[model samples]
Target: MSKLIDPIASVEDDTKSPVSVPSSPKDSPRTPIVALKHKHEDKPLSRSSSLLDMLHLKDVHIPTPPAVKFAPLNVPRHRRLQTAVVATWAFMIPICLTVFYGSLIFSKWLRPLAVAYAIWFVLFDRAWVHRGGRRQEWIRRSAFWKNFAAYYPITTVKEADLPADGKYVFGYHPHGIISMGAACTFATESTGFSELFPGVVCHLLTLDANFWIPFYRDILMGMGLSSVSKRSCRSILKMGRSICIVIGGASESLYAYPGTNDLTLKKRLGFIKIAIREGASLVPVYGFGENDIYELLPNEKGTMTYRFQKWFQSTFGFTVPLFHGRSVFTYNYGLMPYRRPVTVVVGSPIAVKQIDKPTDEEVQAVHKEYIEALQALWDKYKDKYAKDRKSELKLVD
Candidate 1:
């Protein structure tokens, strides 16, 4: 081996150049000074060029966000009428509740009666849990849901005609903020759900807490929306009514970003268990443009916002999505969801065997088939319906 040189000595040798140094004190003589050659001195660069090179600069393509096109300022009379009908729908529930509560406050006698009614509704009036609530075809075919569905101009296409006698548990994907497509297709006759499958009445399941609201519960019940609870699901399935479940729930609403198909379903097996337990056929329904309707705040993983949202879910049993969309006049900025086409596609049904207590392996087997069906639905329509998507379907946890 060659003799080792001291690092300090080598450094000193590198800076051994001498130059004359002027003395600061006028009385002192000039002294000899030492300077070092910079390591990159051979390659001379201008100040700006050197700074740019240090940054390792490269051209970045920042794509322009797509512009939201609104209906013409001078809308036709029919379209204006349609808008009014939609607005009425948006305000109907709130108006009814306000009037009901106002009556309770204004009338002293009504307070005690109202309190009694509430107690009865909470304790004994579980009538909302039955298939009878869903058989109200008159309400399901009403003008309100008709107008609401017509606002989006929603449509449904079945891969194959479902058997009228078969019981189904439809696992609706993406949750889509409020699951507008689920409401339009399953809860109402706007998309002609009845005509598509003649004798099968599909009840859209929601959180049991929704039925706690006074007038709103009646409205939901009238539209045949029952609780998403296991008991409610089993009861409905046993009664021969199909159940449409928003599988992603509130957690998936966090992933409802525009142009992205981020679903929170990889680890969800509760629906599969229910399907197997009730012997309900598992139907995978995908709503294209459901996530694209509203633009939500980015809740990236490990960020405080996402952590807080997850905590909120654990505490409150639901999540709040920070989302915004267009307004009546403006093209892009309001509470109203942007007028995007939401196509609810119903895929082929996966048959499940009824088991009193399904084993882990049995549940997983059904879940795998359900996931594959959902993926197939996505793959089939992604190009046709989601041509402007930013990314392909991501099965997020």
Candidate 2:
């Protein structure tokens, strides 16, 4: 079982005040110290007194309770705007649904338009499935994404330049809580990915289920995000554009505890097969401080919580993790992730030979090489970016 360290109690200390005694103790037999009496010490305890106080536990030192720090009213407008954009992004799915359904219900005149749109979405919407989504360069370069990236202050570090002519598959590691780093870096232009790696147009790939949401689907497509289905990947690579996949997927998200880099990669060979078959260069991207944005509840393996979460993922396509972060109003607890810096370091691409039908051994060989590159990347940046990590980078199945 994994142990969870208390972030609050780690910084607290117990102090003892020195008591002065008479100098005569050196020459004479030690005399028992008499308690100094105060007039109030003899007074009867009130009803409001705690049990410890009533029991005369006067020597006990009680630590002050932890208090939530609320956001100050004088916060800068730009910072507030950043928070608003982040909050909107966080709750975007529900917000879109509400807007869609609310418009149909409240605005009676728009019902026919809504029906038309729904029919078109159901029958003709292949944007999410093919050609790497309806990628709007202007939307990807919007100021909105810049603020979104500033929420975590996400940055992209390019170790080697990727050529424009080559097709590439970016394997994003450690699938941190929502893969926020991946979304900000690849889905949007928040991280200046285009400038960092000029000429390489990248699309962030997500689950097919995400495209099922009405308005949210359009928003995701507009930001250059596509479905992670094999067909979608092939279509994108065929067009000579690259795609970034959170290789760990939903299963890895269960291990997203703060300060840990436990990735589910040993048995993940699908991305490797895709890379080899499509003849795309494999790039390993690690997001440092990705898991430190939120604290997860104890759901270690063998526990019911862990079992249920695993069962849900196996039964459905995703699982819910019990996590908490600071709120918009207060800094103690809420759904808003902590404003931690996420530095996404893009490692040098490993060129793969195009194989029509790769054997298991060949796939494993490529997978091994990819793992080494990812590990080397971690080793290089762990000290500088992941100094606070609790454990070294681990590739857990």
Candidate 3:
């Protein structure tokens, strides 16, 4: 009986034993000393297998640096000089004029002289509408004007030879932030406008308000830039002289973004009418890369910023472009335009019939033909000139 009891007790103990033993040596949760000894014994073989596997696998690629194409040259001096020249025209001149006027207020020697000049400009100076202030020979051939155009390295390409005695009206497109092309090609003969179209003088027209600024007015008059007023256009055309009008005024400059060809000219018929009335031949001038010189901040329609700009244009008769370009120290930031080429292509002239008072239909007909000519210019040279364009020519009013 005692032996039977002992056998039952041993069975109970076996039932109570833990069933936590690992099924295989490799499946063990913890590394025992015995497992370590076996692993060390197989280490040499494992390393040999790894080496063979590596030899059989694909090769790992190690990239090399690209080779330099061209050697660098000294461009900093020219770039800095170009920036200074541009800045002087855009900002320094205006600021300096203000300072000069303030000095006149404090100086007894210059006060009377400044006052007399101001009075003369307001009451007697006929440069705004008449050709009295244009010293064509001196202004066109001046070294200062030459340097101004050379800063951008601007060039004019004449598609066809304009008739020497032909009275003409040049309609400049894209009204770049400042219409630098118009200034270079027409305002100054720096791009050799006289040599290109001999005996065909062009007077570049701008806003009348521009002529109101002190000292700056004299500069504008020297460059032969008159007002875009009806009287000015009529007077210049009646004299058998050509006039270059930046038709896409200040409002168009808002769309003047880099890598874009947008013109606010769909509804602009005033210039067309002027051409018809004066019997002046219409010439379309397109400046490639004019808008690419600077970048304008985005001002989408309906946004507050856009509305404010529109309001400002309506109130002040002029608008501003929130624009920027490269710098002297870096190609990243500043007001200096990038060293991009500006090729002003002067298209073939479109002859307009003389109408003392052109009807809307007549004006529209001329405008349509002008637009077609402008489009042809873009289509012909876009690939060659504007290969980096983000979009094609769009007449966005």
Top lDDT model: 2
The superposed Cα distance between candidate 3 and the true structure at residue 213, in angstroms, equals 0.6
lDDT of each structure?
0.80, 0.86, 0.79
Error of 3 at 324 (Å): 1.3
lDDT, candidate 3, 168-272, per-residue tens: 999998898888888899988889998999999788999988887887888778878898999989988888888999999999999988889989999998999
Clashing pairs in 1: none
Q: In model 3, state the lDDT of residue 365.
A: 90
Candidate 3 vs. true structure, TM-score: 0.78
User: Hey, what RMSD does candidate 2 come out at?
Assistant: 11.6
For candidate 2, lDDT tens digit of each residue in 1-397? 2333323211112253323345577645878443333234753343344455545544545555456689889989998999998888888999989888887778888877877888898899998887777889888888988998898889989999899899899999879788888888898788888888889988999999988888899888998999999999988998889999999999888899999999999899998999999999999999998898888888989999999998999999988888988877887678988899999999999999999899999999999999999999999999999988899999789
State candidate 2's TM-score. Answer: 0.83
The C-alpha local distance difference test score for the whole of candidate 2 amounts to: 0.86
